[model samples]
Target: MRIVEDLRAELGDRIVTEPQVLQAMRTDRSGWVGPGTPAVLVRAASVADVQAVMRLASVHRVPVVPRGAGTGLAGGAIGTEGAIVLDLSGMRRVLEVDVQNEVAVVEPGIVTDDLAAVLAEHELWWPPDPASRAISTVGGNIATNAGGLLCAKYGVTRESVLGLRVVLADGTLIGVGRRTVKGVAGYDLTALMVGSEGTLGVVVEATLKLRRISRDPVVTIGATFPDVIAAAAAAAAITASGLRPAALELMDAATCTAIDDLLQPSAEYPVLAGRGAFLLVRTDSAAAADEAALAARLIRHAGGEPEVSTDALTGERLMQVRRSAHPAYARLGEVLIEDVAVPRSALPAMFAATERIGASHGIPIPTIAHAGDGNLHPNLVVPPHLAGEPGHIPDVVWSAADELFHEAIALGGTLTGEHGVGILKRRWLADELGGDVFALSERLKAAFDPLNILNPGKVL
Candidate 1:
């Protein structure tokens, strides 16, 4: 209560104590709700506003939950009870664009896709495009160190981030990283903050490295296989053969079916209809045509029927199917999205494991993958009766997720690929990181946030 008064006094009308607003902020897209209601929500309009909130929170020893567009799928941006919801979505501004240097300075709240559109005018591009780019913010992507369809070639958000201007737990503003193309000056604190998920500090600004938009003709290859295993194998083969595609995505039989069903009678090309599994590949380099042809050969070798196209609209339509996987699943019932990744060579095994786990659990785990990088998003569709509330996940679902997480770990993979270890996956983080390393991570977290006031009860 005292913290709320302090926040209101410092922030004036920017402070929101309305119960409805607080309730709306209690959960992110993760479907995992916080245990209690947020004490207040602050619509931060600038870096100074963020600093004010954090400074007051530190003085009161109150928890501060930094939030972007609330598109996080790992509960990283969820607001907790007695915590200040530091909403940064309003601070959407592009401060500077150094086109000569191929770098841009931007506010954290700028939408990923919006930034891309702005960059396009300059003939530049930022390639870390998550499926939720239309709504997800740059800050949220940086918080999770997000990867997307093109990650196999361009890498994740961290690779493009040259530097960060962060507000520490004590509200001290500090800048980390460099703008130079090459610098090995000190510890990579910018890298450390990239995936810290708001546990270390609040990211107010980022200096991002940009690339010139490719002018080469784009080639898209759509392939169908007997099953997910075959499609995953084809993807693995393409990766092994050193063919770098701008994007490589795989959708299992169930995912294809769901997307097909969603795009019914008026659908122009029903390529996904009755398909067992589908692979969407795109190559946009100088040798895109040659690379796509070789990729098609690999697909054929893997027992798949491949269709290659150079039409940009056709390519976008195919990509639309891949991007529509989650919404199609959500139409069925309550959806629990799971992010797990394995080595490229182990993709088939992981797909096989999902089949077995889904059968054992008696739940349909419709999966899609950024196959080029071996990251799979398995959607657990829980019927209305079983899925009671928005944030409530049944015990059986958790059991299945536990088995899936262990399976990934067994295959020399990780519990999460792009999504950070928010409340949803924090339980298994120790299993993946081991005891000693996990303990050291906690110590490092303490060194940055001694009061444990930054995103408490999250990411260790």
Candidate 2:
């Protein structure tokens, strides 16, 4: 209560204590509610506002949850009980675009797609295009080190982010990283903060590296296999063949069915017609045509039906089917979206393992993958009765997720590929990182946040 009073006094009308607003900030798209309601929400409009919030929060010893567009799939941005929800969505601004230097300086709250649009005007591109780019903010993407269909070739948010201006727990402002393409001056704190999920500090501004938009025509190849394993194998083969596609996506049979059901009566794009599994590959390099032709031939060799097209509309339509996977699953019930990554060569085995896990659990785990990078998004469909119940995840679903996480680790992969270890996956982080590394990480956290006032109960 005193902290709330202090925040209101310091921030004037910017601080919100309304019950409805607090309730809305309690959780994110992950649907996992925080333990308690946030004491206040501070809509930070600028870096100064962010600094003020962190400074007061440090003095009051209040937990500060830094939030962006709230499009995060993990519970990283969820507002916990008695904490100060520092909302940065209002700070959306593209400060500078250095086309000659191929870099952009932007405020954290700028939408990812909006930044892309601005960059597009200059024939420049930001490669980290998450599925939620339309709504997700650049800050959130940097916080999660997000990856997308293009990650296999272009890399994730960490790769695009060259530098950051962050506000620490004690209200200290610091900048990390370099503007140039190559610099190893000091510790890679910028890289660390990219996926730190706001635990290390609050990112207020970022300098992002940019790439030239490929002018070559895109060639898309759509293929259907007898089953998910075969399709995954084909994807692996494509990667092994050393053909780098701009995007390589895979959807399991259930995912295809769900997409088709969601987009019903669309005669143009029937998602495999209840076939087995689907793969969408797009190449946009100078040799896109040749690469796509070779990829199509490989798909055919792998017992798949291949469809090749050079039309941009057709490519987008095909990619749309892949993008619709999450929404389609959401239509079924409350979904526990799982993210895992494994070695490219082990993709088929991982798919087989997922199938086995789903069958053993007796639940439908419709999966989609950025196949080129071996990152799989398995949607665990919760029963309809439990749908929309805040803070609820069935025991069975957690059990299945536990098994899936272990399987990924066993296969020499990670519990999360793009998504950070928010509250959802923090339980198993130590298991993957091992005790020594995990302890070191804890020390680092303590060094950055001695009082533990920043994003408490997250990513330790």
Candidate 3:
């Protein structure tokens, strides 16, 4: 490209046009190939590098897709044809950790766990614990408004964000939100940008809210029920009992069996061994032991064998398995993870519908969930041979997914709970948001990015 040559000449090796680099930067972790490889990969070293790339892209009318660690599962960071993959992973820097203000300033490229580690040194922590914290960037977490094991109690990334430094599509840099805790200054543009999927603007840096770690509870509880519905019943009971557990997770038989098999047999992994459906509950309040005891008795009353533990190490190992649910599903085969959420009271009905869907489709769909919040991840696994066949793979999986998504909607639930509606779920956005709201969302997108060059086909 003659237009790209100028960028190459000016940026030197910073602007990558090599085929291998382009190929390597093409897709995200969505398990699907992009429509086409990127034309150039810009390893942005600073905010200025990003602004220069955006400026050039705006002038030439080329698409620009902002990317962090590419650990996204929704294809939000995947590059489009002839687009510039603006890689921000090179800009990692923790600028400041303000204990007095309970905030930390850092570049977008910093890994989520790294920021948590830094805050831990100051006796403070950020609680959003996405399973991919080791590999996912804070920018990507903010982009998707990620949730994790502890999110039901601690809140998601959007709740923890204080401010953002974003580069608009036309190369304009601006700050949104505030460093302080309270402010109703305007229309909450910072919240708007938090989950825009890089379609609105490129996030360069962020001011993150932190919290002091609590050691009150020092106890964890585990239980196994006859099935997912029974486990969900126990979860609903726990929630109804007014016992505020910090984390509440659920795993079905298949998910637990696979995780148990992958980890091999061990005494510490009994939470996953021979458990048809399991629930993990943790509390950090002063009533920790009481909460665990009450929760355990409720699980028993709900027809489950309760496994109570004050041993932190054993509980941590079990929680690690819950965190590894998605990865364990990946080991099965080609998978499409469905992020569906229903009312807590309707979880049993949701599981019944899921079972019916699996039975009807003849697809082995393993489910794991943040049961406390009623968010379930139903993983559709396709065999290797079927994946290569024409139409069989997506045809089967998508048909089942359509049924499952509609079931969620029918139950007064949502298409996605934690995962944003990226490429994979864009077609269903209108169905979820309805005509008027979805149309307003389109207007919002146009207002932020008129040319639709930022993350071209994601979200609205």
Model 2, 368: alpha-carbon shift in Å?
A: 0.1
TM-score each candidate: 0.99, 0.98, 0.97
Task: Using lDDT, give the best candidate's number.
Answer: 1
Show model 2 residue runs off by greater than 4 Å. Answer: 265-267, 385-388
Q: Model 2, 321-440: lDDT tens per residue?
A: 887887888887778888999999999989999999988987789999999999999888876655556668888888889999999999999999988888899999999999999999
User: Which residue pairs in candidate 3 have backbone atoms (N, alpha carbon, C) closer than 3 angstroms, thus clashing?
Assistant: none
By lDDT, the better pick of 1 and 2 is 1
Give per-residue CA lDDT, model 3, range 1-460, as digits (tens): 8547867876778988889888876666767567688888889999988888888888888999899998887778888889999999988899998999899999999998888888889999987888888899999999999888888888889999999999999989999989999999989999999889999999999999999877675678778888888998999888888876888999899999888777774786774656779888887788888888999899999899987888889789878878778778878878887789999888889988998999898888889888778888888887576686321346778899889999999999998887788888898888989999998998999998888888889898
Q: What is the lDDT of residue 442 in candidate 2?
A: 95
CA error at residue 24 for candidate 1, angstroms: 0.7
Per lDDT, what order, best first? 1, 2, 3
lDDT of 1 at 35: 84
Put the candidates in TM-score order, highest first: 1, 2, 3
Q: What's the lDDT of the predicted structure labeled candidate 2?
A: 0.90
* RMSD each, Å: 1.0, 1.1, 1.6
